[model samples]
Target: MRATSRFLLIGLASLALAAPVSGQRSDDQILPKSAELQKQGRALYSAGKLTEAEDLFETALAVDPRNRGAFVDLARVAEKQHLFGKAIRMTNKALQLEPNDADAIAIQGEAMVELGAVARAQQNLQKLQTICRQGCPQVAQLSAAITRGPTVASAKTPETPKTN
Candidate 1:
């Protein structure tokens, strides 16, 4: 069997096994205030106001510490600020809450690449491969990031001393 097909079957089986019991809370439940804050944070982020977005995301987390959405948004803001470590950590926190979160996995992979953790990044890519099917956008995005490599800032040349 093709690896992709096998992976798909395994993923399906895992999902089946992980399916919540009837008495368990559904994933759809969300605190209204936290949801509103997350929405506002996303809007700010899209508008390039990363600082404001970060603040809103933090507020959301304060309101509902279990909100993986807030952690994911905070990861994005950290990435925008070039704080790759923070981004990875925040993504991890989100992943801890929701292991199959595509956004968190994708962002964490991107952060690993930025931090020059190629092996770890590859691991995340593999996880994505398992989590997403062929042609999935998250997989495509992480693949592109791995191919593109880390972005390096240009070093400024020092000024030469003037001759008398």
Candidate 2:
């Protein structure tokens, strides 16, 4: 009877070890928040409430320091506020966590464009082309930004009228 009980205990232990936990993410996955802070932050960001969105994203990060989504959203907030340097820094952190993060890469390219680093922005454009060879919104967006950039600059300069 003692041997049978020991075997039952071992079987129970094996079954417990094989069970998958429902609430926690795997190590290689992005850390999801226990609350909906990240989701709410994204909504605020979409509504252009940058300050509020930033606060919520920061709160989410405080809870999950490794939250890649929070880092990406914070980068978007910085970009919308024209804080190009801060955007680049935040996106870099997200990229470190997820090397192939499309949103982070796109935001990095946008930040580079605003900083007048056209050459570096092209690098990201090229990467997006390779990642989404079939074409993607990010590639189109970056291409448009690069194309319209020179026109915007030219418009800023007053053109002298030629004599008739």
Candidate 3:
């Protein structure tokens, strides 16, 4: 995760840690009101509400189909659920919309790696580094992972968030 997303995850972790979690996020980036739904989805995801989070993410996407963030997040949740095929499809949707989005590309790479398509995974991860944001370190980690190949060890944490 990037610093911002990591910070968000830390917040989420505090939320989840008290209960139980886990991203890269942008700073100085103002997401639209549609983020409310995304926030709900993340909270639900942290809460171990995979199905619910999936539904909320779907709803968020419906409300803003162009929101690549939701697609990437949804794909991640699906990946955690061991729904590799679904993850692939969802990430594909994100990639289709934001072909050059570094986060989306990096996530797609991770998904591809999970789906056993190492080449494709490497391709996407490389793209992420090539288009990385300033001061974000998750991109490096992701790129490193791609270079290192699959981990086979899941680092998935809990999905309720800590109250903000």
**Evaluated with TM-score, which candidate comes out highest?**
1
Question: Can you write out model 1's per-residue Cα lDDT over 61-115, one digit (the tens) per residue?
Answer: 9988888989999998999899999999999999888998989999999988988
Write down the worst ten-residue block by lDDT for model 1: 149-158
For 1-164, candidate 2 gives per-residue lDDT tens digits of 99999999999998887776655666455455623788999999989899999999999889877788888899989977778899999999999988878888888988887778889989998998899889889888888877655333344778799998
Q: How many angstroms is residue 76 displaced in model 2 relative to the true structure, after the best TM-score fit?
A: 1.0
- Residue pairs of candidate 1 with colliding backbone atoms: none
How high is the lDDT of residue 6 in model 2? 100
lDDT of 3 by residue, 58-123 (tens): 888887776778888898897787676777788788778767766666666676776668888777
**Candidate 1, superposed: residue stretches over 4 Å from native:** 1-28, 153-164
- Model 3 stretches astray by more than 4 angstroms: 1-33, 133-135, 151-164
What stretches of model 2 exceed 4 Å from their correct place? 1-35, 150-164
lDDT of each: 0.88, 0.83, 0.73
Overlapping backbone residue pairs in candidate 2 total: 0
For each candidate, what TM-score against the reference?
Answer: 0.77, 0.72, 0.64
Candidate 3: residue 43 lDDT (0-100): 94
Global fold similarity of model 1 (TM-score): 0.77
